[model samples]
Target chain A: MFATKLKTQLLLITILPLLLTIAVVSLFILFDVLDSIESEVIKRGDSITDQAAVMAEFPLYTGDVDALQEVADLLIKTHDLNYIRFVDVSGQLLLTENNGNDKGRLREFSSPVFSQAPDLDDFSAPAAVRAPLGSVDIGFTDNSAEAQRFSAYIKVLSIALVALALGLLLVYLFSRRLNEAISSLMTTAERLEQKDFTARVEENGSGELRNFQRTFNDVIASLEQNDAELQQKINAATASLNESVEQLSEKNQALAQQRQETIDLERSKAILEERERIMRDMHDGIGGQLVASLAMLEREQDSAVKENIHAMLTESLNDLRLIIHSLSMQNNVLASLLADFKYRTSRRLEPLDIELDWLVAPEADSLSIKPQTGLHLLRILQEAFTNILKHSGAGEIRFRAGQQQEDFLIEIEDNGEFHPDTEAMSRGLGIRNMKSRAEKLGGSLNIEKISSGGCRLILTFPATP
Target chain B: MTRLLAVFFLLLTVLSPVHAGSVHIVLSADSDSHLQAASDIKAELEQQDAPPPVTVRLLKPFQSFQPAADDLLVTVGEAATRYVSQSYSEHSQLYSYINHMALPEPQAKHWASVMLDQPLQTLLDSAVDIVEGRYHNKLVIAVSEENQSMRLQIDQLTIPDSVELEVLVIEAEAEPAKIIDQALFNAGALIALRDSRIWSGETAKWMLYQSYKYNVPVVGYSQSFLKAGALVSVYASLRDIAHTTAQQIIGWQNNQGRLTQEGILYPRLSIDYNKNIARALNIPLPESMTAGEQNNVRD
Candidate 1:
């Protein structure tokens, strides 16, 4: 990647010398100007010296050495001749200048300018030769005079350099700032991509950058708002799903109750079967013994003994059959199947002067067709009706049998003068027998007082007929 | 404030000898010392004798002798203009077209009308730095080392105003024969110089000064002026005349003594007793002047 950049650098280096050539040419021009000016000055000085030397030689050769020396002294003392001397044929100085400390120029002239006389071959000085002659050496130093000419040049260069440096520095700083901003933008964009819009770009100083920062912050704020709204929606959806789950759980509980009812029916049926076997055995064995005893008594021709034997056999048979029916030896039976059970119950109750109303709907026949269901139902009805004849005082008894959906509903309601909730009220064995029978048959029976005042029995069983 | 003004002027008097009250200063370069001395002497005549109203001109470093319009010449002809402007607001600083350097180019142009068209003295820095940043004059001190005898030694070297040798037959003036001989010799030298064409008429003028004038010196007659301490034929009588005839010395001395910067001022003397003619003449030392031994130019 850098090879091309390196090539560009090399190209720049190659071009730099050509650019510097312009500076060199400018310097050459300056040198030429100085040389020309100096030459002009020197030429003018030489001419003046020649003319002045001619005019001054008048006092030299009159043979008055004092005056000759005076002329020489005048020449030396004059402002121009800075260093001039009158050296005779024998090389004796007449006069010269004396600057005590600043001898730098005199020292150079002392080397060869004085001794390298123009007429080296002319060693002879004739008696009439002119004297007090001065030679001229000149140069120009007008730097202060020309100072204005250079001011603009120097100012231009100084200002240009300053401007360039300032411009370059500011540009470089600005570019660096821009690069940093771009880099930060990229980092923010990546974070934004990750949904971390909360991280904000901090802008520094004044400029468009601050605006960009504010805009970015606003964008993040909008995103946060959106995030909140989306979260609220999600929460609402979750609540709805939870409610659905609760409804399903409630339905499952109901289903479980039905299953349990079925299970109970099977268990109660097994218990009823065991009880029926026991009762049958008792009838066969115990009833035969009693009968035999009775027969024996008859053969002796003893009327008192025969009568006792016959009474014992009859009571034992009746108690054993009641035990068998109370065992609830039935399966999958409906409680409402005991439709004619009420007729039978009232018939038993009539000699006792007990009133019983046993009512069953036409639909109750469906429940009664199942003998297992009818058997348990008839037992409960018989017990309740017997209880009404034996215990309840001045009572009107009601037995209702119907089908409510798949359930057999049986209710035994009684209106009796005896207190319904009083512990002092006698509960006959027949009522207990009725309640036990209903429970063993996988059904429930409740005794409640009606608003009109009386006991009411509500019995419910699965209509599995 | 008044006293301060007095002190400022006093300092100015001390630093500058010729303070032309209303005239702007002009400095020009002159390579001819003799002519410059004559010119200076003439100018001082007016400066010293004139009253307070007289304005003096301050000629700058190494003034030229044969300037197209010498300061004194311009003064004599009244060719000088006074630049007494009421205000200097309009004048811009002077600028040279050559080497670039800043100058305190005050508005002397507007303040002072164009006085003369002569080249002014080189700018202050220009004049002072003309000698390759070195002293332009050689210090040739020739001291007479003997009490009765004129011994060969240089004590101090003084810059001369002008130097020449002029010869006249003061005693031989009545003798046409002697004058003719001298004139023929001088004239022959001129003709010979022209024939050779090597030395121009300028050289002929120098020859005339060397041969006849015993006062002014010949140009480049001898090269060993510094080494021999004093050149030959430089009369001892010259020293006495300088003492007696130096009427313009005060103004010149004052100018020389006044300085704006600190500098060591040594006595300016030029010849040594060792020169053959100086010893031959047996010149006496001034009562106030001290005699000394020769000093090395190297020193």
Candidate 2:
């Protein structure tokens, strides 16, 4: 009962005071009305007794019983008297008229019957001048007072009920509106639990309810701000992670390519070292023995078998030197290999009393060349040199290498006796080998007779092949 | 010479009495009773020689007359008294023979009355003397509306010791038996004042009979009341009223137009008792219970 709903509490708060006020006022009015009614009854009874005393004065004084009876009967009929009795001073009951039945409710009023006119100057003054010849007693009832009290009770109770009802109605309406406002706030809170920061409650109530709505909205706005900041942070972190992943992939790819390039470099270095070692062995052992043998054969002078053996040893050593030079120079630049070839051929030509010219462009020196292409170019160059040393017997040779439009250019020219059948010499194994080496280098080889030379050789390929 | 001067002063004193106004004696009728009382009053006033010359008028044949302010109008009997007091209320008048005249109807200061009833003092004295040897308890004084003045007059008088006076005031239209029954309660003797309303032929007989039935002796105002079964009677006759009226006129003349006392005045009292009635009640009458004036007391 004490912790009832808001509506019932409001109803009680509004109606209890109204009921209390009505009850207190009704009690006050009822008591006042009863007092007034009793006063009127007393005044009326006193007045009736006074009148009866006056009327019975003459009859009682003269001992007129019939006249007194008449007066008493007249009083009972006219006024609200229940009964009236005239008793003489001698205690004689001269006349009486008793009409009332309810003796318990009757109020008796008595007045003195004097023979002479009394002094009425003071109404409350004692009748000192005239003694009572007799006295008249009149009886009355309080029916009207009771009826008035009953009527007042009904009216007061009705007013109290009406006021209570009106007050309760007003309180109920106010509390209902308050409850609805709170319910709206409850729903908004539910939506907030679902992370719907856009949800809002209507801020329409009094006092605490209004404050609650404002606070709820404020909290939701704060949450929305926090949510937006958190979402931005998440997106930023994801983007940063993606960028980091992409950078890591790129770095991994670069690292793998570097590893492969290192492996290729190692392999190429090993092959180049092996080829150098072979080139050294050939130059120290086989090439020197062959040269000594060829010199011994020259000292034999005019022996047919010794001249044949010297020719065989020189050819075999040249071939073995050519193979070693190709292997050793496989990873070198075209210009560097060409310079090496020029030095080697120039040394050989000095012994043979031939002058060699080597020319290479500085711009062509930076041109990268693959190992296979360098090897192929070296073999081709060897073939050309061998042709110069064995067939042309040219005293001096000239070599040049530089950049053309998008390719490297190499040319070799030597002075030698020209033969009509030199073109037919391309069909020979040595010329064919030179042509094949140029093709393998993705270049063209051409042999032409120079005007002041024995023969001309040209080779062209891409600069960084 | 001193004796002769004294005689001369005495003769001058007798001849030099002051006189004022005419004295007119009006009688109700030429009946012996009224005429004799009228003549006696006239002679008494004339012997005093203190007022104007006296004149007598009998009202049996009804004469119309007017009186001056200082003229003395002496009325005898009830009819002549009411007529003169009513008609000539402004004149100095003396009224007698009337039992009760209602104070002259709005009252005149110049009018004085000599009642035929005895004064309360004389009646009480006579009652005390009569009931001296008897075993008495309480004295009852009763009156009707017509005799209301006697009640007032008796109330001012002191009653004898050893007697409780119960004053009963009766109305005019009362039942005599009922009034007598209330008045005679524990009464040793009853004093009944004369009133035409109560002492009428029928009610008077009824009251006397009721008093006798209650074994209470009654003192009445007139001899007729005595004859109606009352034990004693004390009253003033017309002649006595006339003599008292004359003395009042002389006193008024001496007092410069003011009566010696205000209101109506009564004559010297006389006592009369019915011996037969007293014997019937088994009560002895006093030796002084005579029929004529025994005391000159007047009020």
Interface root-mean-square deviation, each candidate: 13.4, 18.0
lDDT of 1 by residue, A129-242 (tens): 222333322222334324533553565456555655565565556556655665566677778889885777766524887688778878988998899899899999999999
Give the lDDT of residue A119 in candidate 2: 21
Q: Note the Cα lDDT for every prediction shown.
A: 0.39, 0.71
CAPRI tier of model 2: incorrect
Off by over 4 Å in 1: A1-161, A168-191, A195-356, A360-384, A391-397, A401-465, B1-193, B197-299
Native contacts retained by candidate 1: 0.00
Q: Write the per-residue lDDT of candidate 2 for residues A1-465, one digit (tens) a residue.
A: 784665456557766776787778767877887788788888998888888887776677678799888898889889867888899999888877888566447778888876543221110112334546899998877777677767867876787677667766776776787877867887887898898888999988778878978988898899999999999999999999999999999999999999999998898778777767778888888888888888878888676787678778877877776666656664366566666677777777777888878778997667767656766777788778877787776777788888888878888888876563765775678778878878887778887887874777788876665
Candidate 1 lDDT by residue in tens digits, B1-299? 43443344335434644433221222121123222322343344445554222222323321322222111111111111112111232321111110001112233332111111101111111111211222221111111112111111111212133311112221212332233234433221111101112222333333333333322111111122212222221111222222211222332234332212111111122222223422432323222212333321101
Error of 1 at A195 (Å): 4.1
> How many Å off is the CA of A368 in candidate 2?
99
Q: Ten-residue segment with the worst summed lDDT in candidate 1 chain A?
A: A107-116
For every candidate, C-alpha RMSD to the true structure in Å: 24.8, 22.8
Docking quality level of the chain pair in candidate 1: incorrect
